[model samples]
Target: MTTAHDYAHQNQERFQQQLIDLCRIPSVSTDPERKGETLQAAEWVAADMRKIGLNNVQIMPTPLHPVVYGEWLGAGPNAKTVLVYGHYDVQPAVTSDGWDQDPFEPTVKDGVLYCRGSSDDKGQMFAQLKAFEALLANGKPTVNVKFLIEGEEEIGSPNLGKFVAAHRELLMADVCVISDGSVIALDRPSIGYSTRGLMYLEMEVFGAKQDLHSGAFGGIVHNPAQALAEIIAQLHNPDGSVAVPGFYDHVVALSAAEREELAKSAWTDAEWKEATGVPAFWGEKEYLLHERIGARPTLEINGFVSGFYGAGSKTVLPGKALAKISCRLVANQNADQIFGLVRDHILRLAPPTVRVEVRQLASAGPALMDLNSPYMAAASRAYEKGWGQKPVYERGGGTLPILADFQRELNQIPIMLMGFGLQTDGAHGPNEHFVLEMFKRGIDTAICFFDEVGQIK
Candidate 1:
């Protein structure tokens, strides 16, 4: 009989080609023009599952986009069940958006495969699939594995919560693994126990019914863009903390032990500064870098829109202005409450000349997990076995709403986050790529993770 290592080592070239093939599809969920293309990507995932010897593979439809699911239960009920989550969708990308190569076409240069979705998810997602391929190709897996790959994560997962809530029974598992994020480095594999929540919104400020010539209304009326900027400027303080009332009312203070664990991570402030190419670091001044980023709540303006953004100046007093806003909520914070405080603050700051409207585009609560769970330890062991280093525990500063949803839907099961991508993989950006060396190591990690979980059950 073949071993998982033999299958993985022998099939390295095939797995690389498969991932390159997956990256070739431009499954941009945010673009309406690419709806058919996104569905095509879903079909590709489903077909891959079938070819890998999964059963009951199907493209489950959601109101907005489709989810692809497949399962292998050959290990039977005495063993633990593992569920995996990842997105088949990617952020919108095009050559006009500053790409050195076609955004959809996959190319490898110096051992890096460049393409949108290569690292953010497609590459990481492939890690899970290839694990099953290696395991089952050798023998029946020690744990039953189920895959839930969605196509709407890039657009705030507008329909996934409802889908998971509706199919709780069919999706039940002992543990769930998500590979959408990245470790600090190839050697410093990390696992996260908590994920920040999200609240995204759009605020509109209307000054006049129609645009007026600057010469006619220069001094006579207020500028909507300037007013909007003023409101945004007031959101933070000199210390870089949010100035909005009650913004940090629910923030959970970091425990002393947690602070100690955070100090042990392989990342350093110097490495962070070098990677970002920033002059210096700035955030809530009182907390450490990790504590400030993942353990606290944050508010940011995603984008701003106003008049006269064309080739030159149109010389007009803008009739209206708009700003896209988002907030990262901590464990005890509520997304709705944060949105309310922000909306009310905007209303209070608006002058009588302009009408303010804040529309809540999306929201999801933050999630905290028990880092001491046995399976989490099992995952750490797997990382050590595959990557030849002990893994570190960390909290994710970004929001993966589905992680919160899975806990709410299947509270009895533990969730595992084992990321194989690197921080510099350039996910959600132009010329995105994944390190081929890390890809091979990630497959080995997944193989070890499944084996480790079997012992606990």
Candidate 2:
């Protein structure tokens, strides 16, 4: 009798083509103009779910984008149920963003599929779908499976919390598996147990009500742009730590044993320099680079804008300046409290010459999974059997808003992050791509994970 792995191997070509088709739709959730395309993507997922023998497939609408949900429950209720989560929406991309090809047009070159959403995370999500297809084609899977692919992950999943809250019984499961991130490398597989939270904010400094000529009001009026820059300069101290008081009050310090384990995955300075091309590293000098990224909190200026210079110099000191800031919070930190502290600090730093306003755009609390759960052990065995390596435990530097909700609403079910792609895949940037090998292995790993979970109970 042919096995699920054999079925997956036989359907590799078709799976690759299916992924290409899905990635072709530019489902950019953040762009209002691409609403139709985003809906198309959701419809596509629902259609495929029906094709793959999943039951109750639907395009559930939300305040923003819709969520595509499906499930297979051939196994009796006595068996374990695995909840799979991923996002179909992608970051906005264009050829001018430094891509050699159209971001929506999936391109295959040297075994890498280049396209937006391939790795983050349509490719990974589809792997779960295909794995179930293979399993059902071969025989009945011992464990039941459900899919919860959403369209708003790119925008912080603002409506997902409400959706999950309203559908607790529908989404309740034995465990949750998320395949939205990257492994340490192609050869070094890893499982993520903790993810950092995010707090995004926008700050605007106002002055002079209208544009003023630099020659007319040279030193008399304080330029909002200059004042904004001055305030930003004071946010960080000389030692590269945030100057915001109370920022560290709620942060949890890493234990000595945990620090030792994190060090195993720390990027060497040479590797960091090779990947980033930075002249040198900057941050708290005491912590290692990995600790600074995965364990410590961070404040970053995502973007800044002010008076414009079209072609030549406009010679104007614009009325206002705007800056986009984001903070990555660690465990035990609250996003709302941190936002208040940062906002108050910025306001205090503002000079009387300009009016400064700070507003929060988004926030997600940090989440830590139970590493000792049997589901995590199943993930480890799956990686070993499917990818021929024992996976290492790592703390992810990125944020996934749904994990916190799953923990809160779903009775704190164990969440396993079975990342398939590599970090160098350039997700959310120019030349984004997913390796064909990773896609195939991801399918195999998902199948193994289900089988391993089946052994439980």
State each model's CA lDDT, in order.
0.89, 0.92
Candidate with the greatest TM-score versus the true structure: 2
TM-score of each: 0.82, 0.83
For model 1, the local distance difference test gives 0.89
For 90-187, candidate 2 gives per-residue lDDT tens digits of 99998999999999999999999999999999999999899889998987899999899999999988899999999999999999999999998888
TM-score of 1: 0.82
Over 4 Å off in model 1, which ranges?
30-37, 92-105, 108-110, 201-240, 266-282, 301-325, 345-357
**Clash tally, candidates in order:** 0, 0
| lDDT tens digits by residue: candidate 1, 1-457 | 2389779989999999999998998999999999999999999999999999999999999997899999999988899989999999999998888899999999999999999999989998998899889998986788898999999999988898899999998899989998988887777888888889999899999997999898988887888999899889998988999988988888888888888877877358888887799998988888888788779888899999999878975898999999999999988888999999988988898888788899999899898777778888999998888867898889888888887788889865678888889878888888889999888888889999888888884
Candidate 2 Cα lDDT to native: 0.92
